[model samples]
Target: MRRILALLLLAALGALAVWLYPLARPLARYGALPKGLDRPLNLLVLGVSPEYSGYHKRAPERFRGLTDTLLLVRLDPGANRVVVVSIPRDVWVNLPGHGWHKINAANPLGGPELSVRAVEALTGVRVDGYVMVSLEALRRAVDALGGVRLCVERPMHYTDRAAGLRIDLEPGCQRLDGAQAEAYLRFRKDALGDIGRIQRQQAFFQALKEQILSPWGLLRLPQAVAQAEPYVRTDLDRETIGRVLGFALKRPALVSLLLPGRFGNGWAVDQALWEEARRVYFEGQEVAPASSLGRVVAVVYGPGEEERAQEAARRLRAMGFRVLFRPVDQTPGRTEVLENGPGLLARDLAEALGVPYRVSGEAVLGADLTLRLGGDGRGL
Candidate 1:
């Protein structure tokens, strides 16, 4: 019902605003958020189900339906680190006012206002903005981009009879259309269950982000904007939206991240760990120090460059990289800045560090100073 009203309001506003587009500058300015915020800015992202299919179709009569997908986007402009913290929608959390409940319940309690409060209470970081996307909106946008080419990390399998969603996982890498991508987002019950789905969501969002920032995607921006205007709800106003879109147009390397915190058995979000997440994110603290944690920082290079490789490790170490497990690989994955959430933060520091890791578990055997970032302990 609320979503319906919002959508109707959107349509009416769009119709009127198309004429009032000239007035949009002032109207738009009113809703603008403060730009130039510090990096790792927390953004609450919720994947909501479609409110209404069409005029003739009746709406589903459920308010407590599963939001299922939850992700906290940490945007750090200063350090250029984009950290995303993924929380299992089903993972129960210690909610304020009410006894423990699923974190998604924060929405029902209060829309963005309450959800922001709840997440802030949980992680102690101020949410810069909220992007409430209807499940359909994302699908539409994905389709508009001519269906994103998704890289499947692993086979995903799940069936939700109640939700009317089904997924079958195929191992290795694969591409998925918009519908398939939505299924990918909906699928859980892999080895990690809800947790696994969270990881996929990160990858999916990354792929979407990449696609949207692509040249062709930019050309199709008009359609994507149309799709989002009616269904997507966010506190960010048009100008802010335009500015961010411009950023995408210019600097499209927005990083994607999943908090490196591994939930224990049952996957319940612990109260204490919630605070830990807060510290890592809000305070720019490193959860795992480079000196102690086992990470292999391999300065990737071609064959017959062992001496140069070792020299690279020493160079990185001199620059304060842990360089724990050095490996000399002729071929390596493209360089990616992956962080293990706030857990890999160094105490007394303001930002979480992005340390290199062992490439797909391969060890480096030759090089001047092999850049291998591996192991299980913290470094000095």
Candidate 2:
């Protein structure tokens, strides 16, 4: 009886170790939790589209295309907020070793590593990890989910004989199969061009979010993850991935935003606007004493100070201010900050911009706080 009990105890210990390995192994090995996994994280997600000739046939590696989509996903578990910022593929940026080129080219040149470096340089944000998904993987994942239902706003029809691609989508609410869904996402030949396609993509994801948040969808997550694992590549460890997946299952609302830029020959970044968007969406309100009040701010600058105003706006926006630039007719001799009433936001703005401010006068109607740029704008 004693011998049997000892053997059973040993077997139980083995089972316990197996169960605890995933959680405790990293701590034991590194003496710390995985870097940036448990706290706020910025993950770069790329969607790669490889060209194929034969129907439903996986092509060779030589024919793989550029990164079709680039997204910066910021996860703040403490605040339970997830912000996804989409970067347009056509945006022109300087590649580190290479000269000027479209952002999408970074992927094909050196794969995900180069892509990460290029985006980090362009946005001035550190990427904690990255996930790359091929088209085949997306197709399989969508199919595994038993198809997603979405409302098509208009008729979409396109065909490219060279690539053997076809997109025929009628306007209505209906269930889209894998192939049809792919076509819907890949369509871009319209008046709005890539912008229109992005809108549709956003809509599709919203519908997908609803489907995934359902009870039935939750049950199928493991199966979906297993089926799509082979095609998806990522630098994140299994533990971190598991944490992200668990958090996503909670169905916390997602905030989707576009990188603020102008589309010329390629998308040009408006430094001021882009920084503002980043602060309000990416950087949470934790800096100022009363940071929540800086959700939306307006800036009015004097003549001969457009550049200064833009710079000031950029800095303020990056520090969690929703800065809006509005030029005024009257010019000031020096920089001045104004607010409607007693609030911590004005003081925070003044300190951030290194300018003196007052607590009276109508700065900008409907704006929480206002900044006026003067001729001798210091620290702009």
Candidate 3:
């Protein structure tokens, strides 16, 4: 009886260690991060398209294809936020040893290492690791999670017999299965073209993040990761991945930004905008308080929040901001500040309001920044 009790106690202690590992690892490596900044883990994610004739065909041993999607994700453990910057595949770049070509071509020309180098050159940001995943991996992961719920902003219909791709979805909020999710992601036939597709990808990512953070999603994560593992190639070790996921489970703030550029011969980089993004989002620089004065601010409040919105506007006016009020049809779950231009105004407003901020593609009321008052802003 004494021996059995001792063994049982040992097993319990081992389980506790396993459960605590993710949280402890990041703390141990805190000193390794750069000085004057939160330790941000930057990951370059490449989504490889199918090269074979069939969509379901097995992937080649070496991932060779023009990347379908490219993203530079920053996981800032200190700030408790995840920032994602989407790079358009069509952006023209001079690949080393290969003449000028689309940024996506970097992957097929050399692989992830070359791709990482090209990205580092383009963004001037150091990438700690890379994750290359096939589209089928996304499908399997979604299916393993049962499915993800997303809102379809408009009716979408596209079909391609050659690639075995089809997308037919109506405008509304609904749950999407594996195949449907893949189709939703791959469809780029609309007027906005690749840019529109990028928007959808961002929305999908936001929804997927929410789903993953849910209690059910956490319980099923192991199965999802297992199903998708075969199609993923990554340099990150399991322990490092665990630390990132563990940080994510704490419900960090999420901010999404698109690589600033305009389409011409190829996507032309907007130098000024890129610089701003590099400083604030990539480098994690804090916005100066003095820059907040005289900025145009728009407050879009949810239904029945007019009083709170007015009070918020009064506070903003007192801060030397010109305020505009707009009423939104639906209520948001949390407060958010949207930046319309390359400035750090949104970051300042978000910081002032104690909420999260994201870069917006469109401007609201021609304001420098827009404040979205949600249920969580009742105190304001």
The number of the candidate with the highest lDDT is: 3
- The per-residue C-alpha lDDT of model 2 at residue 319 equals 78
* Between candidates 1 and 3, the lDDT winner: 3
**What digit string (tens of lDDT, one per residue) describes model 2 on residues 191-278?**
6576567656766776688777777765564455555666667788767866776676455566555565556787776677567556
The top-ranked prediction according to TM-score is: 3
Tell me the lDDT of model 1 at 239: 58
Candidate 1 lDDT over 1-380, as tens digits, reads: 99999999999998765644533443344434434443344678777654444543425523233455566776656555555666656655666677777777777665666667766765666788887777677777777668876655455667765556668756433557667878888776655566666656766766676676778876665566565555556787655555554333335244343333345644545456456555754566655544533334434443354565566456556655555433332222233233333423222121223333311111222211233222223221
TM-score for candidate 3, residues paired by index: 0.73
Which digits, one per residue and each the tens of the lDDT, describe model 3 over residues 1-380? 99999999999999776654443533343312222323679999999988864564545646677797999989887778778888888888888999888999999898999999989998888999999988879999999888998766567898776666778987666899999899888888876678778868887887898898888887676667767767778887656666775776667887777777777876777778777767877776754544777888888776588998899899999989999997755555457788735446777777777787877542352467878786663466
Distance (Å) between predicted and true CA of 59, model 1?
2.7
RMSD vs true structure, all candidates: 11.5, 14.4, 6.5
Compared with the true structure, all predictions reach lDDT values of: 0.54, 0.70, 0.77
Arranged by TM-score with the best first, the candidates are 3, 2, 1
Once model 3 is optimally superposed onto the true structure by TM-score, how far is the C-alpha of residue 291 displaced, in angstroms?
Answer: 6.4
TM per candidate: 0.62, 0.64, 0.73
| Greater-lDDT candidate between 2 and 3 | 3
Give the higher-lDDT candidate: 1 or 2.
2
Candidate 3, pairs of clashing residues:
none
